[model samples]
Target: MVDRLRFFLNRIKERLWIKPLAMCLLSTASVFLAKMVDVTEIGQIVPLITLSSIETLLNIIASSMLVIATFAVGSMVSAYASASSTATPRALSLVIADDVSQNALSTFIGSFIFSIVALIALQNSYYDKAGRFVLFVLTLSMFAIVIITFVSWVDRIARLGRVNGTIDKVEMATAAALQRRRLTPTLHGVPPGTHVPGGRAVYGSLIGYVQRVDINALQKYADKTAIRITVAGLPGTFAAPGRVLAYVTADLGDFTDIDICQIEKAFLIGGERKFYEDPRFGLITLSEIGSRALSPAVNDPGTAIDIIGTLVRLFALWCAPIKDNENIRIAECDRVEVPEICLRDMFDDAFTGIARDGAAAVEVMARLQKAFESLATIEHPVMRDVAICHSRLALARAESVLKIHEDIEVVRRLAKFGNSV
Candidate 1:
């Protein structure tokens, strides 16, 4: 239950309106709270603040903040559009969820709301002399906040829509997702045996991607029914009416519709994939950006090369050794069996598109060969084997696509370099 709620809240945070709405509410509350100063002893000792001075400050804030807020919105929309055009549309979410940009816009709208509310309260004579003094102090603080935010926002907005900036955001998100998966390889559940135990199958009601799997809910159901539940649809798995989400190793006669409904509810399906629990989605999104860059219309091999380097760093995190303490599994889900993410699938997600699209570009092919060579050097045998395998595949792609004999030779030499490593 807690896991599901946290997942829900994280998705909510991604919506652009959440921060601004919260800021507006707080701004409105602060105006009323300022009036409470009239009851305090400090209000009696504070110097008198004239109504004209307070009105003038509020007027300045009201007049300027709305304009600034409108400008901020326009700039952000342009940035979003630029990100979608230059990079993959999948990366637009990360660009929109950028903290600095969101906070800056929130500050502007909040300040505008504060000024408007304060102006109304003053017109109604809501504040006494002391209360007016407190309001004056708040107004000055608001000005400082707006100035600082605008200055910081100016710097961030400059790069927010650029290709490099979008790639960086996607890389960071992918890295974080990869790290989380590394820590909890089985998602805190016990790893499956040789094969999933077969029995009754449970299918999802919807046709879409599985965004999250509520393991705790499955565990509870398993424990109550004295059955073992084997998860079939992990996060990122596409769901349809006929697809089995999980297998219940119990008698079909004993299962009820309510029981099946409960199991299906544990898997949250959405129209699109998310980067949170699904690391492959991030990998695929990055590969798409690289592939798009290599498209005929873009013809930018440099971006593709940059993406190769970023993927290398992200994959390196997977090769990093996990401490014994960090490897502890959550024993609470003893009745649930979940499959670990496949290494081969991950490699395919990270490199297949880039390899296919960038085969003709010597710089891209060379960088990819070097990337494979780097991964081959890692201490893990499986990673080394996979790297060598991909190196061979990429070499084959280059041989078929490169028209020039010199370009083929260059790529072939680099591909062989991985074997020597």
Candidate 2:
């Protein structure tokens, strides 16, 4: 339930309208509340604050903010287009969901709505002396917010659509997902191991990616029914019609449609995979960027080399165990089974695309070999083996692509090192 709720909240936060709508509600309430306070009662104690003064200020803000909002929208559209053309399309979502840009636009639009509401109330004689003072103070505070937000937005908009900026955002998101998975390798459950005894398959009704899994809810159901549920497909796995979503083992009775539906509900199926808790998707996006960089039209080896370093840092973090303070402790069922992400699969996702597209690029291939060698320094045997395998694959591709002996010799020397002296 926590994982699913986190995923849902992330989706809501990414939407461009959610923040503005929230600000609108707050703006409406502020206007109404200010009007309810009778300012005349406190006029003698607090000096005179005229409605005309506040009204004039609001009128100026109200008129100017509409144009500003229009400009902001236009800027956002241009940024989106720039990101799509320069970076991989997969990264466009990160650019769109940028908090600085979204908050700036929301602030502009929200301030406009507030000013308009205040103007309407002023024209309707809704403000008493004290009410006018309250609105005046609120408007001044808003002005500060707008100025600060605008400055930050201006600084951010300069680079928000750049390829490097987009890559950083994806890397940040991926690192967060990887950290969460590190804490809960089995996603807060024990590993199901290879198979389940007497486990019957539960098929999915739709065809899509498993975006989220409500493990807490599933555990609750398992406890109630005294059954063991093993999740065959982790988040980011593709599910087709009648494909096995999970396996159920219980002595009570056969699986009913209601039970199957309940299982399906725990797994949030979606048209596209999400980066919320899917590290694989993040690696895939990074690889996509590398592939795009290596394209004949782009022919940017530096970008691909940069991504090699990024993947190395990510894998290093993944190899390290979570500290006691860093692990998120929560109540989870012991009967439920989940599959941990395989080390080899991550290597495949992070390297294959780059290898395929960057084979001929000596700089990229050398960097790729160095990255695998770095991962080989880790203590895990599986990680070392996977790194070695990918290094060999990359070396072979470099051998076939490089017509020059010097370039091939460099790659061969690095591969021979094998992550050790």
Candidate 3:
């Protein structure tokens, strides 16, 4: 259930309306709360503010905020478009979920709603001396919030849609996903050993990407039924109709249709892949950015270099050892099996496209070599071997594309650290 909620929230987070809708509800509640506040006792202590003054302030806010909200929406749409064009379109989701822009827009809309609500209430004589004072205080607080949000939004808006910003966002997302996977390489379950488990294959009904798998729930079900369950698909895998998602082994009998339906619910299928638990998706998106920048029309080798550096940093994180203290092994059910991510796959995802596209660019090739060199130094033997293989592949691509001896020599020198050729 918790994992399902997380999946739901992640999907909702990408929408622009959630924050504004929440803020609107809060604003409406605030207006109602202000009316309930009793100021009769403190009427003598607090100075009585005139209704006209409060209404005038709210009028200004109400009128100006409409334009501000519209402008903010326009700016956000423009940013999304710019990010899609400049970076990979897959990264537009990250830009859309940007906290700064959403918060700023929510503040504008919330303020507008509050002002209009207060203005209407005042015209209806809903507020007395104390209520007017309460409204004034609320308005002041709203103004302060708007001011802070606007300042932060101003700083973020300038870079929100740019290539660098999108790269940074993707890197952060990738790092986070890698970290999560690194900790729980087996998704809170024991690694499945090689064993012949003869059981019925339960398949999903729809064709879509597997967004998330509720491992805990699967484990619980396994524990209850005393059945051995092996998951065939991970979060990033695509599910086809009648495709075997999992294999269930039971000594008594095969699982019923209702039981299969319950088991299938553990896998969350979506229209598109998600990056929250899928590090490969993140790596692929980063590579897409480098591929975009390396295109002839863009001819931006610098961005490709930047992406190489980002990939280097991400792999370094992936290379770090998982602490022994982390509790990834679940004791309840050892039957739930999950596939592990191969270093070779992630390495290929990170560097293959960029290496292919930027083969002719000396700067990109040099950066790619340096990135592998950095990865080679990490303690993990698999990381070293994977980096070494890519380094050689990158050098070979460069060797084929590069015409000048000096350029070939430079790449060859870097290749010495990876392969003999």
Candidate 4:
């Protein structure tokens, strides 16, 4: 029973070894300091006579163990920090683009400091016996190693402070997703009878700026103005993909969990970045323009002539049944009419100028006929609307210009010479 009890006592001591070692080290240091003050004997109070060979041996073992543990912790933290910024990518390419190796350096510095300090403790013991002195030196070296490694554990915890922000962000997103799903899963869905703007089969999900707005009840919830934003795959017929389309207000909570960085991955310049090159979309494609397309460089006067001519012919063609059989010799005065050009410039100059300059109804009507006659071959559906809308908008603006045509000197001069009579 005595032998068994002794074995049990040893096992318990072994189990509780680290705490006792720490206590012994602190106590011995305190006693040494007391002896330095000339107030205590070499073995008085602290560490309970720790100048002994047995105590020196125990100290050496304890220090070695601490350094090993600290080093292990530092290595693990270094690897994790490296992976976080370098390996895991986000839509914002620069999100974690900063240095990953910096964290590893931090662990290295912290552990190094702990190791050196503990090593000094090992070398400076006040023991009288040579065996105990040797043991003290070994103890100091081992303790330095353990302290350095243990410092890494402290570093691992410190590093967590740096990463706590990312964790909080992720948590916020997850919570927002949960809340939106619970409150309104159909928040982004379309209204009755109308699909999303692009007529796409499935819009998956989206976020967009309200470029233009006509909301009746938007003020009830949030801002009533339109905010134009360029989000991924959110289409608008009235707007090109990047064009600001409307003013709108929406739920802030609904947008909270949205990963805007994910959407940026779909673009070369990023969703936030501007267009690197001008895109004519399908308007400038080959089917309409052919290999070499026409452009407005051919003639500036031709739009006014061509637009007016097309309208007259339309009226003539619609009114006179026999005109279909007749070949009209409307001159192609515009040397620059391109294959798919909208002639926004022409409408801006010719039609709007006429309307604004107070041109007579008969004169305005005549010039419009001439402009349409100038380029009568375009017939595609949307492009045709482009022309029609430009003409209409130009005319509206021209009428306004006519009211204030005196405010525009060049317009007044052009208006003076417009009449062929």
RMSD of each: 1.7, 2.0, 2.2, 27.6
Q: What is the TM-score (0 to 1) of candidate 1? A: 0.96
Q: Estimate each model's TM-score.
A: 0.96, 0.95, 0.94, 0.19
List where candidate 3 sits over 4 angstroms from the true fold. Answer: 1-5, 196-198, 252-258, 323-332, 419-421
User: Candidate 1, after superposition: displacement of residue 386 in Å?
Assistant: 1.3
Give the local distance difference test score of model 3.
0.86
Candidate 1 wrong stretches, greater than 4 Å: 1-6, 251-253, 256-258, 323-328
lDDT for 360 (candidate 2): 96
Spell out the clash pairs found in candidate 2.
39-130
Q: How well does candidate 4 match the true structure, expressed as C-alpha RMSD?
A: 27.6
Scored by Cα lDDT, where does model 4 land?
Answer: 0.33
> Residue 195 of model 4: what lDDT?
27
Across 343-420, the per-residue lDDT of candidate 4 in tens digits comes to: 343234223433333233334433543443332334434434434554444444545535444433333333332232
What lDDT is reached at residue 375 by model 1?
93
CA displacement after TM-score superposition, residue 54 of candidate 1 (Å) = 1.1
lDDT of 3 by residue, 148-218 (tens): 88888989998899999999999998898888788778886667778864588889997999888888889
Question: Who is ahead in TM-score, 2 or 3?
Answer: 2
Residue lDDT tens for model 2, 11-60: 88778899988888888789889865673466456557787778777887
| Lowest lDDT block of 10, candidate 4 | 285-294
Q: In model 3, what lDDT does residue 19 have?
A: 97
Better of 2 and 3 by lDDT: 3
